[model samples]
Target: MPEIRNILFVMYDQLRHDYMSCAGHPTMRTPNFDRLAAKGVRFTQAYVQSPVCGASRMSYYTGRYVGSHGAAWNGYPLKVGEATMGDHLRKLGMDSWLLGKTHMTPDTEGMARLGLTRDSVIGARVAECGFDLWVREDGLNPEGPDGFYYATPSPYNEYLKSLGYPGENPWHDNANAGVDEDGSVASGWLMKNARKGANVKEEHSETPWLTDRCLDFLASPQAAERPWLAHLSYIKPHWPYIAPEPYASMYGPQDVVPANRTEAEREDPQPVYGAFMNNLIGKAFSRDEVRSEVVPAYMGLIAQCDDQFGRLLDHLESTGRMEDTMIVLTADHGDYMGDHWMGEKDLFHDCSVRVPLIIYDPRQSAGSTRGTTCDALVESIDLTATFIEAAGGEVPEHVVEGRSLMPFLRGDTPAEWRDVAISEYDYSCSVMAGKLGVAPKDAVLFMIFDGRWKMMHAEGGFRPMLFDTLNDPKELDDRGDDPACAETRARLMERLSAWSRRVSQRTTISSDQIIARRGKARSKGVYLGVYDENDLTPELLVPITGAAKGDFR
Candidate 1:
């Protein structure tokens, strides 16, 4: 019976669901995350719509599938006029604000064609992927031969320069790199440099900086005016694979278990599988030395993330903001880190597509399910619908493909729910696609997880990749060609085909409005397939017989 005053959706970049101590990580401990899970339902099975950042985040913001929104990869712009969480929450008197990275590339061309400028409110929301960005830093600003990965002279670089750090790109030179004994900069892009401590201090690092920004937002006059959905997205524990101070040396090579791979996976691999295994990033991570140097740093970054998040939680409780605020902790997706001979996410393995989803609903109904783990299938996009519902608004069925998780939070079993979870990827823009000689239009991949057997459907005539996740929990074995799995494969293929045919394009109007407007056209004096006036129903003909409706033609 308690009312929801605000929401905080926290997304950590590249955090694996299993890496959390509550989720069974042997080494990493996230006590603050554990505290949140203890007060709410922890979903053991949560899948994102895509394995990559931009596409998956678009799904989270829009509450639609990848195919529905059409922003398929990073740097790919989310088209203008999509109904996003901000649009929905704004209608319900809740403001949606962004604190950190969204990986959003504004649809500049689309906005230009529509005569929209970023200076306007509607245009600014669309430009930021439907959120009022308070501070946005993607946190990875590598300079390639062509140009920088993101805009040069970013806010983060300025902040570092303000703190007395030298150089044009302090973000890369100091924050992500270290000084060797020779006094030269060691770039962290290479795994060999990961063990070295970054030049920046822990207090000024990315995660801690973002946490400070969150505190600033909470104390701002705008946040105090009304209810808000704060998307405190952190770009950390992702790449550059370096940490500052004690965090870089906290864990060693011995702490990490061996990378999850096998020699059998290399021999006679599938076309797409072999392509990814031999790709640029893939081969680098395949080396044992690379995995050894990188995993420790990766683990340390996750530790930093845990500490920073716990810091935010402490501030919330001290300010008494946790009483009516619903908080959701999740990730865009996870990194592979040499798993399946892959360096980064692009596959459908649990290491890639699955993410941590923990929600704390500070309401009386949620108390019964507190500290409980839910094995029910959950999707990242579902948070959009859940946020809308928490704001006391109904989800627009035609627009949002994700269902609300509120029923689960209330300790009630929904009478109906989806039987399978879905994830998709468009690798046409990836170098791996070129290695396979795949056409741009045919480089898509889809994953269907039915709570047991998972099937990865590849385009361009590549056969489906199947894995018995329950029996072979590590997913090292690919049962795609096994004759015994033909039945399961066919069933999943049928399900995939059915999912493809969903009503994904009709976003302007809600299905409820359609149902409510049913049969009203004829009553408003428009008639169809009537051979004579007598053929129509008496009620329908009342308008036709009226002086206003008759013989106008």
Candidate 2:
């Protein structure tokens, strides 16, 4: 195979597959991503191996499952020595340039020490990756001058403020107004915007600049000759639930409001797991003052991302770089977006795990397969293999789990492709699932989605919940107890069991050991959070003083 010249990867922070036009989303309009899908292979059923941001990203970058790498959750570091895609690509003589957030913590000092006020992505232990350049932040969200909906000012926070919002805003808290089928808003104040269309292009906002920087890097002479890799990670559609005018009103709250819960759904046994229900949103918005306008603003935010993405694509095409470049557009994971009464992405349901995965192979096809959606199961881990293979490099022998999607991207699905995809979480293992019956014990919840059959096996609370996704796409009903679905459940369980064993072998950290090592770190006053494997949010954690790093562990 000939060497591929350039690799362009665009990963959104928290994007849901159902929100993309190419993924059967009739209401959302993402022309650029949609266009890419038209010409390339679209994995209709793509899921993150790990549900959260850091863990899922680790899986993709390392070509290993999250369980294999010890960075099980956010705020945690990957084991001291792990080979990343950047490392492997560099070995093949590729000049890797990371444009935006990589989510990896730079050093033990954390964000504050690296000239970062918030969680910016920095690859501290990425020495082996051999990236030529990394324009990274510690966390995924970029702080603008305007600050987030309810945040204070800082280097990153000021970026949000410059966009024209109060200096202290926390849009991430909860502003999801529950939308009814008839288009009436019931819960959030996302619509509480003083100025809309006029300020969308505010200079301080980071999205525009992130794109600009990426373009600048792409245009550089070095990129053309070295076969560079650039990951344009955008922070839009992630929070504040506010959008500039016109777009804020582009889709009326009534126009874009998707399916809601029914009375029967309210009574769902798996209510805790359902998406787009009042029970979920109610948690975020009990105050009536700011409830009704949240959805509209949130919709507008997504439109902004789509628009920026289009601009980036246009620039690539205009520069004559679109044809030779291999573009992969997807997200780290999905967001609940007021679904099932939830606001962020820290769950195991499709709302948090299934994301849009579009691979555009400019060398092989372009606009050749418009509207073609492949239903094959694909996980984020495959990306490492796909990129290596696409760049005419060898897939690392250490990463044995991921299957390259190149064959499928070329419209060839080998007979051995797996039919099911699995995801997991280990944060609340002891509380959610019983401690694995072993020393230094931990619990885990494993999920398997195979076509219409979806099984969630927990260690404790719920032994296992099964859903026929086709019959109940919303997953309102649990068929685990129904005798008729026994065979289906059994088949899924077998897969789950096999996956469980595989994960066991791949387990990177023993809960006891992490606590011990982290305990010393925490005593020194470093803010720490434990992200669950399935859910990125810290389940059980302690905040150490942001005091000196040496003061703590």
| The best candidate in terms of TM-score | 1
Q: What is the alpha-carbon lDDT for the whole of candidate 2?
A: 0.63
What residue runs in model 1 are displaced by over 4 Å at the alpha carbon? Answer: 537-553
Q: Candidates' lDDT values, in order? A: 0.91, 0.63
Q: Name the lDDT value of residue 112 in candidate 2.
A: 38
Where's the lowest-lDDT run of ten residues in candidate 2? 169-178
Structural similarity to truth (TM-score) of each candidate? 0.96, 0.74
lDDT of 1 by residue, 382-421 (tens): 9999999999998888898999999999989999999999
lDDT of 2 by residue, 457-553 (tens): 7654444678788988887676767899888888888887787576434334554565679546545544346344332223223342235657554
Q: What is the lDDT of residue 466 in candidate 1?
A: 94
